[model samples]
Target: MKPVLIRLLLLLAWAPFYTQAQQRFSFEIEGGHFLKDGKAVPIISGEMHYPRIPHQYWRHRLEMLKAMGLNTVATYVFWNLHETEPGKWDFEGDKDLRRYIETAGELGLMVILRPGPYVCAEWEFGGYPWWLQNIPGMEIRRDNPEFLKCTKRYLDRLYEEVGDLLVTRGGPIIMVQAENEFGSYVAQRNDIPLEEHKRYNAAIRRQLADAGFDAPLFTSDGSWLFEGGTTPGALPTANGESNIENLKRVVDQYHGGKGPYMVAEFYPGWLSHWAEPFPNVSASWVARQTEKYLQNDVSFNFYMVHGGTNFGFTSGANYDKDHGIQPDMTSYDYDAPISEAGWVTPKYDSIRNVIGKYVDYVIPEVPAPNPVIEIPSIRLTGIADVLAFAKRQEPVESPVPLTFEQLRQGYGYVLYTRHFNQPLAGMLEIPGLRDYATVYVNGERVGELNRYYNRYSVFVEIPFDATLDILVENWGRINFGEEIVNNRKGIVGPVTVNGMELSDWFMYRLPMDGAPGPDKTAEVRAGTPEASFLHRKPVLYTGSFNLSETGDTFIDMSAWGKGIVFINGKNIGRYWQAGPQQTLYVPGVWLKKGENRIVIFEQLNDGPKNEISAVKVPILKELKS
Candidate 1:
């Protein structure tokens, strides 16, 4: 036979095998059980946000979940991380949802996509783009026409990236969540009519369907909140729920008493705020819960088998009648089965043992631990004052203080300057201070106001014709509860002196989107004296450390007060002396073999020593009295 004819015959013989391997399958919730290809399958899943974990570590984290006997990997697609600005969409690099989903499928694991227009995953603004607040007549997560229109556009754009990866399209994505925890929001919001909430949720569901997300849809909320959160025709799932009886009852009540029940967000550990003690769930208790879930045939997903770093300005705030504005700590660790740096904990082993007993197939061995390294302390010299950099930019003039949203600024600090015509001394009150503010009178730091404690007023003594600069840092937008709608960073309303309102402001946009480089530092250092640079204020410090080899390391900012750290131009995360999180996780993949740059935008480094050490472990809790 001729070589060409033989090759053609071989290709024809293999065609069917290849086609079958890539064939799509039906995934349905029927007879109270999850049916994949007409066979009942128990979904043991774990939640891990793609944006939270570095793109390079996605496979390792997913593998960890599979080894723990989780057949599925669930993730929340952060919209803010994608469309950072209005009309500017990004689905590349770390923000690539398609690649992440495809990677999971390649590893023989299914995906549960929770692409929320409002995820409320301790993410800034519940994953809503900052520009959404700037739109006229915009009301988020509600029946507002502008919000609905924007949501449709966002979902349409998202589907363009991952629509082909749906289970119906030969992809691993079996189910998708429609609007996260809407029932909680509806319950908290009393002013908005219940009918309006229903309309908004229905609109989100329609939008998801219209965007070609043909996978089975589910709505996750607390068991009691199914009434407000569940959309018509979508399966209702519970969060933070374990009782099989209650879970079945809620799902049956909202979803026609069907059998396939799922606890969409089973909380193994709780989220931590800056000042509060780091929350830790007992490993044995979690194991017990897992056994209960499996024994009762109730499918469950660990809210975060591995809660990666929040990185950049992504960590969000939580506000309620009891807690007020509690901004989430940068380290999203969640104290899950898998640590923030991808290290398996006792919880991981506990959960694995529980799952191994129930699964029919052999669980894969846990992958080897990632390498971790420690570097000696590197001295970071004060190179620039944040306000000094702000002075270089032309200020936006307004009669009253404007918000970070009003100025079209998303994250970081915004310097609001007001020139006092005469010497004014009184209780200066900023009624609309969103989060944290540092008051300065003519380059002299006076006092500070923290929104976390609801302290928006401070005593200020202004010099004649002095410039009153209120440099406000946007800790993060409220990600949970009803306060999310009221989330406008920086100065939102009027700044009053005693009982009178102050006016004539010069707002400098210090969004601090990127770390200041040597060129910027040189300019500030050369222009200012060393004596003036050591003041207790927000200062930019720069330094470099040599590394022979790279591995995962934590940048210990225990010496520093509060600030954001950037390594090799990458925004690692924020650090504060407020306790609970003292070190920022720096993935070794981001480092080079030789010299690596580190920049600290220190908000309050009062001590003489200006240094940070690359430690081996994380310091999650250090509660100050």
Candidate 2:
């Protein structure tokens, strides 16, 4: 294999990361799916994100994926990960998307690029940059002149960096999506007009073509013939919504009535969140569809071959009660064949057997599984009894009002504070508080406004000569609804306290970047560990374990709360006490010859220096999430 280096740098914005780009790629598009240049490419693609998985395991994961007979790799371009602010973009470290695509090229695989200014990959803000929320009067995901205008600008900027990588242009990318599943949900037109949708779709295609991306631009839809289907120039394509028969209909419809088929989203698993029961997508005869497709010569991409971490507040959710309004959990362990900790789940072996039939080379042996951390349940005190550490710090600026986009932060809470110049009494109303809110009068907690129920306003009573504060926690934005998607965190509308509207001067910032580690002397509060309550939150816990041998171990995290895990300072991404993701993987490379330190930040449980043991990967029966 040639040496490959990838730079996630946003090109000319940040100093470039100096990683090798793969020297070559092989791709050929016939009726549709890309085949190796000289061969009839019966391609297999899997969806996973380099940013989602730990940076260190990119190659290991890719190698394993390829072994599964997946010749094509697909990933989403999380705009937030690149451009947190409008002009500033970071493609280095965890944000190194460029390196990822280029590396996939190096691995002799073709790639599908899902560069959505709004990719609803269960991401914090559906992959749209937070800055969009600050555009004043901006209507996102809609065809509003303002919305499309910004969309064009973002697309233009993005194309400038990777436009040349399209497959038609001889680059690794075979397909590029024009906004994920737009046809399946409420298009700006569905709520507005059909003409608007057509125009919006046309305009997007024009922009992509104008920017010279050259690759076929496809739209991913759960519904096949609604309008958008993938064939690009001919018709757009559709991924079956967890149903193989339906998937065939969509793919067949795209090929002018009949042909081989594929599912852009062959569900390897399902997504879940905090307040709900586990949303499980287990293996069964339906799960056999993956093997079935391969056996039948159909080309498809696993929506998420490897579900990675929704680290920080990057997880997303649907607002509709039918789908439940809770935000997604921090851990995105989609019950994929390849576990988030990077283990080869039993599901992996099952799919590999199904795919092994068509591959040219002998399937590479799956790497030995990582060690599992067999966490022994134990409880700790005093740490929970410690005093609040952040209340004493200067505290993040909160007197000035801010929006989720303005702060350049995504999912999570934002606080806005301002002292009332004159005192007045009436029903104070904040026409909107984005999603959720907690009101404080002179630093004393008063009450909170809840939006989990579709309420539009929060009424608070404020007094004279007092500093009124509104702490808005991001309960999660609406991922499955038709309303305000640009629905960011913080105060979304007018602010009124006690029937008196207060204007001018305010402060804001999530202060959720995380606190200054753990303190020996700190106090803890219950009922709000997962949300940012500042000082009342739990302190980080750190410990060391001696590995009798330096080997890969999946840190058994079944006993912990939601937060991140690190081995000897190497981040293994986010984890949750939630089942299905009870392990935070620690590759042997990050281990020490004797002892290794492991640090954890439990968002909920404040207990124990638990013991960990490596465990087996979990896959859906016929597939699992």
Candidate 3:
């Protein structure tokens, strides 16, 4: 025998011995059922994102899942969350993926790793780093070489961190997803050729294997998009509403009447976008689905067992066929079995009871609910003007309007100022106003252009020579649709005044992420002494209160128009009183006893009184759609 063949044969001879010594469990597919150590087993999994929840609460959430009769925990590893800036990966704090996986294993639960270069979980830029937008000839989630190179680099780093945790390496991770719902995505898009889509899937799978993932690779697609999204050699799984027969059909068709069917994303509850009421999938409906899967001996995973908060400007928007530019609210509390605040709900009981009937394993009692603190109302004073604060930011001069990425701005708002040379009047057209913009003449609010309403240009009547300011807020990038490619924020084209192209523009990038607090209030006052609430400029409201105890609470923003909030120097999330989500969730882990600080950067504060209140429970279901 050849030396290489002899060595390989010897390694294979010792494989079982080594695996046994390592206490490694064999997880694979046999016939049509998931088998563990050659015994048929069903995977009862629930989806959770570690970054969305506090690092301290991982175990608690895992325990909740386990108590609810889940044997596995599936999680999506967000690329953007880890690689926010190119070449700079952040796995510390809540972004730690290895720790999360190990914690699940320690809880006696298996894990299915869904590490996506593009995780379309209503996440900003669909989990692609915003910096990728500036790359030359970069096309995301497709067969672009530049995009694939960046993806490979990220995957290489990811595998280095958690690849050893796979089942073959004696870790609890049994399977690693090839990519998130790719078959469904490339199905209807004409921009990508079907052959190229298949090649891309094959390339990603090859890359994963090269990175040393020995476990089974799988692709998730909606039943309708199974043909296009499925990889030729990998396991194919379907996701959708409670329809077991349809799921089986999709799996069977993909596998050539083979077994081992799986539903990757079984939606117990749906995601709620801004302005739309929270989607409340009935507990009985969830129970019925859970029962059906258990009865049919089918392996399934809940889309969100615990949909946590989408902190900061990480929330995404959806461009629907019927509704245009629908932005997602910051509160990701998807009304799941485990609430965003880490508490169990009625759905928990329903699902637990249903699963208990089919399984012989005892389901533990649900843990006691955490104590919720009701904070008294906090009075906030308008401390500074945002434009006044903008003086510190070095302005970029441009003849035409610039996109946010063009000026190295990631999120939040941007200010485009132009000093009028002569008296100008008529329609001020920003042909490519990416989303929402507030038009101001000489610092006075005139009109607003909205992307959702398809209202772009606004009539500006400049009486005399005055400065024109268009403060644009990036509502959100479209997370899913054909509009994903053209989802650049700010102005992507020229700004015209009465059919005349305007030049000599002063662009100020307002990425108000880490704005200074009360100490910097003096700077704004010094910059614009005449700045007042009467003016339509952005306002930074500062307030501090003493907390006797720290617990989960919802900061009420029913009175506020639209803005983002910061508590104790940490960004809580954005809030808009447009009905659905009226409050932002404040995790107890973020708060401290004694003096606590809050700063609000209100884009449009409709105020007779600038104040905020906190309640004990989260307002999960929206009162209006």
Candidate 4:
């Protein structure tokens, strides 16, 4: 043992193959034409943001990536994630990006780092700190001096953290993408010419150079990703282009010849929203693309090998106004080969089968799939009454208006309280009510807004000396697109009543935590989502099952409204009544026999009571099956 240890210590090359492997890398397109070492390496990679998976599961997730026949793991360097606050940084917790890099190396995988100070990955503020938005005349992504200053700061910090992880430094990072799909949104910018693109890349280039990091820099964009994206230096990048000729355009247009070609984001399955059905593309179609890429030696990266959660308010939405997609569910389940929980799907197996039959490498057996058991449905009734506890003791003043930011609360509800001038009631218009709102006159519920539709309405009646109160909840910010850049919570703008804009609002905050606060349970009074079922402001219910032994189970979500679920004490994820997500995956780790507590906090009411149980099968479509 001593001799072996000495020999191993003496041979420093004992590091993993990825850590010791060296390759000159470049991007080519279509037909597996990307060349490395003067030959096509025909890379197969998967995108899994480091912050998405829990650190404990990093290696597990990487192993899963490798098992999927992926030779590379791409991750985004979420600036906001690293630097939670400006000038301050945290590389631990979910921010341990350095570990993410080293782990990839250890797993014999390559790395593609996307360190966008403006990484628009459906993150809050597109990865910008909220304080940046408060800056005067501040602009993000493009060339705003404030934005540039901040970007540089983040770059400096990043270099200090993991610059050595580059392949040039004998690490797994073979390539780095400048920004994702920048050309897709160039028109919204200041309409600057290509020179603007040059300036951005130039600054990045300068930073990398100054850091003594010479791992080969490249910018990636579509054949036209260059239009809005930083061009010249950025490697030409594309996604989901199955045709060899189409990829040729990107490489030919940029490299003028051929080198390393890659699909930075190859979409296999699509993402689904609250109301929409699953956005599933055929697994066979995706398998064919993978087969072609490898057969032709084209290197590619799956857009999301694992799409993690948009926890809190960071979920970005499509079109700027909708915060649905970006904030993705609490589940980072991208419907990729790998689910958010690091479980490999059938897509993974299909992709792996072809790679095994066709490629030179052999991947190990995957960790056993999570336990899935069906819990016999339980009828849940009025365990106890739930209702609101009044906090304001004084005579409530005129209608008070409060903005989302002023509330000092990130997500959830905000209360605006003010006294009316005289006996009055008319069509109430909350023009500045940003996302979602629930109108209550004198502590009685009157109306609500879906926000996704931009409107939810009802009539209002007031008595003499009436107190005006409108509670607007920051349901969620739009999780994708340009709108995500400015996603603020609560009543973003203002609250209006009739023709007058309410002012001097007294405020109340309702984050509601997860599920419902049990102590605030209301008497089971009503039975519809539109009515107040809980007489209490918050509600809580508890149930226990003696397992004697714990087993994996699928908590059927068909019976519950929108709320969160907990086992023992871990948050599984948010649950919505909306289908096709009728089940929540619950690992047995959080459960215990002899009496594990299950608590539920449902905000809206659709029925008098509900039921929950476990399932032996995955309730989701295609991917799980």
For candidate 3, give the lDDT of residue 165: 75
Candidate 2 residue 539 Cα shift, in angstroms, is: 6.3
TM-score against truth, every candidate:
0.94, 0.75, 0.93, 0.82
lDDT of 4 by residue, 155-257 (tens): 8778767776676666677776665566665645446566675576566566656655565555555555655564555457666667777786666667656
Best by lDDT: 1
What lDDT is reached at residue 31 by model 4? 37
List the candidate 3 regions with Cα displacement exceeding 4 Å: 1-24, 523-535, 620-625
Note each model's CA RMSD in angstroms: 5.3, 6.9, 5.2, 6.4
Give the alpha carbon lDDT tens digit for every residue of 142-189 in model 1: 888998888888898887667767888677899999999999988999
Ranking by TM-score: 1, 3, 4, 2
Q: Pick the candidate with the highest TM-score.
A: 1
In model 3, what is the error at residue 45, expressed in angstroms?
0.8
Query: Relative to the true structure, how large is the alpha-carbon lDDT of every model?
Result: 0.86, 0.61, 0.81, 0.62
Q: In model 1, which runs have C-alpha deviations exceeding 4 angstroms?
A: 1-24, 522-533
lDDT tens readout by residue for model 2, 61-149: 88888877788898888777777666676667767666677667777778888876567888766777666766777777666777777
TM-score head-to-head 1 vs 2, winner? 1
